[model samples]
Target: MSERSFRQTPHTSHDGSNSSRLSILLFIFIFIVLCLLARLVYLQVIKGPEFSQAAADSRTLSVNISPHRGTIYDRNGNVLATSVDAMTIYANPKEIEDVSSAAEAVASALGGDADEYAELLKQDTTFVYLKRKADMDAAEALKSEGIVGIYYIEDTKRVYPYGKVAGQVLGFVNVDDEGVSGLELYYDDILKGTPGKLVVQQGGGGIPIPGGTEVDEPAVDGQDIVVSIDIDMQSYLEKRLAEGVSTIEGEDGRAVLMDASTGELLAIASTPYFDPSNPSDSEVGSDSLKTVTQAYEPGSTFKTASMMAMLEAGVVTPDTTIFAPAELSADEYVITDAHERGDMTMTARYVIQDSSNIGTSLLVENYLGFRPLYDKIVSYGLNGQTGIDYPGEAAGYLSPDVDTWPLITKYNVTFGQGISTTPLQMARFYGALVNNGVACTPHFLISKPQIGETLQYDTEQIVENTAAIDPMISMLETVVEEGTGTGAAIDGYRVAGKTGTAEYVDEDTGVYAKSSYNLSFVGVLPDASTPLVCFVGVNEVPYERNTTEVFKDIMTEAISRYRVVQSD
Candidate 1:
């Protein structure tokens, strides 16, 4: 209205202002369009693959595939330990429509509590393991029921065919097939094969897509292990040893039979042995293979090593005699024969044959000396592990300070009262004694793939003076023939053996128990030149009971199985 007087002037002003406003609006619109275009380029070019991968990852799932564990075979191709094809029961809880019904179906097939199965099926998780390494037959039975969301994957289960035979030696595995003890633990790496994988795309409702992107990487199987254990022999030994131990009502017993020439561990057994099939029921320490794992004062069994030392060192001869008294005092300890007797003159042979403690003491203290005796003890592996293939071998106890040994300690070690040794060590010692002074390695593994260093047995001469072996063996023969080990004698076979009746050391007091004794017999069969070393020992007997019955039974079986020629 005011512009009526100056209409022309006002129109120019308004037109100029409107033109400037339009120009500013056009510039803002163009800048916004350019910014949107830049954003499009950045997303489509720079972040495209990132988003695509994220979307794909949301649709994929990966699962591990277990490889087949290798089989364990005995020397005669008998299966000792092996893996059987099985199944792992798993479930998709989210996909299951009727959790209660599905769980009942699974339990009915797998033979479990339906309530427990229901608890598992009610989980919010997409994937759940209903049963790991379930029996194949059981899983198949479950599959036949066609339970919704229940599934199975291939797996393996370790099994021992021969129930309790060689159970401790064979050891047992966990639910995942991992070895936990004995040879199974010793060779776990070789037995556990490399695992594989299954990568598949998850489709709608989190179920595996059918005919969708899937990749399967095959598993590499483990290598097989072949051991020297003869299943038949092991089975026989286990039965006889258990029977023998139970008969006397002895606390426990252990027995080992070895090849005199080869040092191969033919059979090892102990009372109250483990059953690999039911490892959960085994005693805490019973999983140990007592033949190698347990060490105790060997009594007269250890005398053979020291006696041989005396002969080799020229301190005594087979014909040499020593005055063995009914009693002798060395420091604070009293030394005496196991049986009460009057003082008598005895040859070196009688010291071992009669299992005379006083006689053995006189030789070591008066002639062999502590230092030489200690050296001999180590040489025979009485004070150390024999490097057996088995795990947890006890390195026998021997005092390092021989120079400071008490006179009684020195005396006691000569007769195996102070020193300790395992049945396996004693077996190996006898093997070397009869095999021309060469000790073959005590082993169970015969052949296997070279995983690490090849297994080598120590064939070094433990008995340095080979000449002394024959004489020592002669004395051992007399023991079985007429000495304390007369109970070990077998008809029509010239057997050589030694009896050990050392008192058990009190676990709490560290002193010899008054009533308990570790009764043991170590022997060789046929003759000294060709022999089979057998060791049988029992613990905590009420009185001295001969372990020879067990030895005779086992040896008789061995003679027949090995075709050992009868000694004339």
Candidate 2:
């Protein structure tokens, strides 16, 4: 064969082969393109509505199911505060085409004026909350009106069934159902349930399609809390204390009943307390949980600590005699007894019974002196915060340094002047006296357990001194039987307590004000067994003489309410 013919023949065969390969590749590419086009058609037309609806559902408008706040119950499982399902009214301003008409319908149905509702509906925002925590009846009425823009969102409304009974202690929630004060604020995380999300498709009119829906994450409810409080006793104490405050015409008062052994706070109350149900109606001044938060000079009630110090330092005994006259000089200040006792020599028990400043000052000076007395007070947990579960606890003012002690410091401290202590701190100090001199840190919450069970937190005994407690208990008993706290005596129960009338200091002059005083009574119930330690303080009382009355009312009510026996 010729060379040219051979080259041309090979070229022709190569061209034909290349063309066939290109055609096969084209066919495969066309098949893939056709398959893709078919899928697009199926998704856009044949099954488009279902898929598109699903996509739209994926874009969710959620109503937050704020977890049901955990129920707060007393030790006996009496409900203090609980969460209930309620409907919250919200408006989709975008959906209201006829603002005036929709607003008029909503206003008539929901008991509001039409103009206000119309203005709310005309706002530019997509969502506007009309009212949170609406009752079932109100929600139903609004639904019946068939207002175009209005919607109901499910939410948890905090309900304090007992109302003002434990208002200060239970605390109420704010508009958004968030705890704003009291236990509600303190235990917000634990009590606030986890919020959930709801996913659903919105139709043409922005209305949720129920059957045409997506996935929903159910909300987890909060765990319940069982407090150390006793509801019956708490209610009784609140009622009696309120009555006493009103009758005495006292400015304000607070009372706390605690289990001496366990440091379990049985009942806590403050006068002018707010009702958690209608928080809007509550006065701001009455909202404080004063028992654990407010501090005041304990007055002669602190003599218990002084007596303990003296006994602990081996300075005096129950029978040890001291010349408890009208006044005794300590440092540059002269401390005098409430009543003049000429040149009377009295035992330590008598001194406590008389609530004598002279006797206590002399006794403290003779035995504990300055350093030891101050140290003992600090040891008794007086100078520091009690570390309670409640919030806003004041550690109180204890001159950080004794060297900075004023000239009258020693004398003032001898009789609970120049010192400040919370009611809870005083109760714990007294608790130490009755509980074999072991000062346990006081706690409000009994325990925080997992869902369905109650956990009991262990009591921490901060101080253990057996030497001083017995003698102190004896002295406290004497005060109840024959001392200034005689009015605190219960028929069936032996009581031990002290009365304190602390003069408030004039802010401008830094001197004791003659007209103002904080009257307080600190006592231990069932004197023989010494199970409960209670402290009631009324601030800015008009007369110091009425201090004993405050003690009597609280003690009597507490004794009768708790059924504490005299002998036991």
Give the residue spans of candidate 1 off by over 4 A.
1-57, 212-215, 449-456, 508-510, 526-530, 566-568
lDDT of 1 by residue, 336-355 (tens): 78789999998888787788
Question: lDDT at 209 for candidate 2?
Answer: 58
Encode model 2's per-residue lDDT on 1-568: one tens digit a residue.
7566434444334788899999999999999999999999998999999988777655546666667888888888788998888888888788878887877777766677899888888887656877778777778888887777677767778888888887888887886667888888888888887777756456654565567544477788877787888888788778777776776667888888887887888888888888888878988756678888878888888888888888777768899988766666657667677775687888888989888887777777676687777887887888788878787898867775777776578768888988988888998988766676666666667656564554444454434557666677778888878878877776666677788878777688888777677888888863444378888877777765544555666666656666666554
Q: Model 2, stretches more than 4 Å misplaced? A: 1-60, 203-215, 328-334, 341-343, 447-453, 458-464, 506-510, 526-530, 547-550, 556-563, 566-568
Instruction: Please list the C-alpha lDDT of all candidates, in the order they appear.
Output: 0.82, 0.77
Worst 10 residues of 1 by lDDT: 4-13
Root-mean-square deviation of candidate 2: 6.2
